[model samples]
Target: MIKLTERQDKILQIVKQNGPITGQEIAVKLSLTRAALRPDLAILTMSGKLDARPRVGYFFNENYEVKRQAEKFLHQQVIDYKAHPIVVDKSTAVYDAIVQLFLEDVGTLYAVDSRGHLAGVVSRKDLLRATLGNKNLHELPVSVIMTRMPNIFTIRPDATLLEAAKKMIDNHIDSLPVVKEVEEQRNTYFLLGRITKTTITRAYLEIMER
Candidate 1:
């Protein structure tokens, strides 16, 4: 946790926006001597807040800051950060799924079976693809095109936000279905909620400021 002074923040901002600008130009803009700025530059670079190249001067390393903060926030769990999921039954029609998707404004929907186990997953794209050349939207079952269990990718509520984010990225999926195992029933998983890239990003921004 490195905290920047007002002067350092200003310098970093200048370098970040007008980076590769000469040290002399930065000093002039900030009304400081090259000598005074050198120490601040050294501290910034040493703290991994800035990257200085010989001919390129100074540039803010966005990836460095993101990585550092991600490490700090990696312990956050999906259960604490996940949003309420939009769910539909496996027998739901494509027409109804479209209505639900629009009503909820969600990109993905979880399909559960009668036993309260995850049955499949359907995306807005799946419904759209199913409806493309057909006039039988009402007759089509979501299960017909949904990604079935054992094939559906899921994340536990206890999983770290970073882990959930990585899973979403790796699977090329927009959202992750968060599940909780029930002790009463064997092989039964309940849909706890959902975690999306948007959810993680918003949470990261909100908490990182603290």
Candidate 2:
């Protein structure tokens, strides 16, 4: 939905409070001529924010608010709010990985090989399962439990926040690794950042408040 101008908002308020009001009456309230208010009325009506009748005037469209919110989410780009990735080497010990997870206070960590390409993803649950009844956390490599490339879900930097949120819901995961495709490699990607449910929630709050 298109954003309303201050005048348009005032007009909406007037029509809402005094529903089925005529164009002439609305113009008078705004201290403007009917001709001057014509364009705004047409836009609001065309955009489904207002409905008009031959003899009756204008009334608020009940569905406009929902449409406006959906449009807002659809336009929000992920790169604007994506956070830095917390990473660990694939060969890092499970014990050291657990320490890093708590130290960083994050739910997930991206594991990379020696060349720094995204190799796998390790979640808190993965680490927990790995450490149960195991005393050799120091010797056990994180690679043992990490979700490898073919199974790891990821998003691109330019994807919309709505897309990011949908991926999390569809995959039943808490976070996604943001990556850029390598020019020379066929299917390899370079990890750029991370987007999570928390990031989307914060973005929604910021947008709504603004």
Candidate 3:
């Protein structure tokens, strides 16, 4: 959804109150020139907040309430929903990674390099697959099987939860590693936290409860 500016919001309210009203009329109410309100009117129309007919004037979109509520949900940022990340060293044994998964009851774990920068991602399924035909789990480093950098999908702390959810759904993953870039030259990032499908569900539930 398009985020509305303060002036745009005011324009929406004006149209709601006196819809099918002309732009010139709206400008009069706000003590502004018709030219000043023209841009706002155009924005509102394009955002689907207002509908316009050449001579009939602007009418507040019939679906305004639903769209506004949707905007609320989609704009909820990932930073607000981030949870502590379960991290393990890239050199950690496959057996140890398996233990961490069950002990924490998390679906995925982040693998960090020696500097504590994100290196890879290991999932419960990956650990299970490693155990199927392997006998030396302890001797096998998770790095051998973990999804490596440049291949891993990650979310930034400031990204929207909607983006996080979409990425998870598109990739068939349940969670994302929330990272903050510390070294742009090397493109290395420190794991700040994580976001999961459960987190998105919980947030929606909380919104509904309110």
Superposed Cα deviation of residue 67, candidate 2 (Å): 2.7
State each candidate's clash count.
0, 0, 0
Tell me model 1's lDDT, rounded to 2 decimals: 0.86
Candidate 3 residue-wise lDDT, 1-210, digit = tens: 578898888888888889999988988988999998777888888878899999889998888778778778878899899999999999999998898899999999999999888999998888888999656999999999899997888999889998998999999989999988886545688889999999989987977886
lDDT of 2 by residue, 99-179 (tens): 999999999999998989999999999988887856699998989889998688899889999899999999899999999
Q: Supply the TM-score for candidate 1.
A: 0.63
Task: Note each model's CA RMSD in angstroms.
Answer: 9.0, 4.0, 6.0
Q: Tell me each candidate's TM-score.
A: 0.63, 0.71, 0.67
Q: Give the higher-lDDT candidate: 2 or 3.
A: 2
lDDT of each: 0.86, 0.90, 0.89
Question: Which pairs clash inside model 3?
Answer: none
Candidate 2 segments whose C-alpha is farther than 4 A from its true place: 1-10, 28-32, 73-83, 129-136, 158-172, 196-210
Residue by residue across 11-112, what tens digits does model 1's lDDT show?
989988998777888999998899989888889989898888887688888898678766768778888988998888899888999999999999998999
Worst 10 residues of 3 by lDDT: 181-190
Best by lDDT: 2
TM-score, model 3 to reference: 0.67
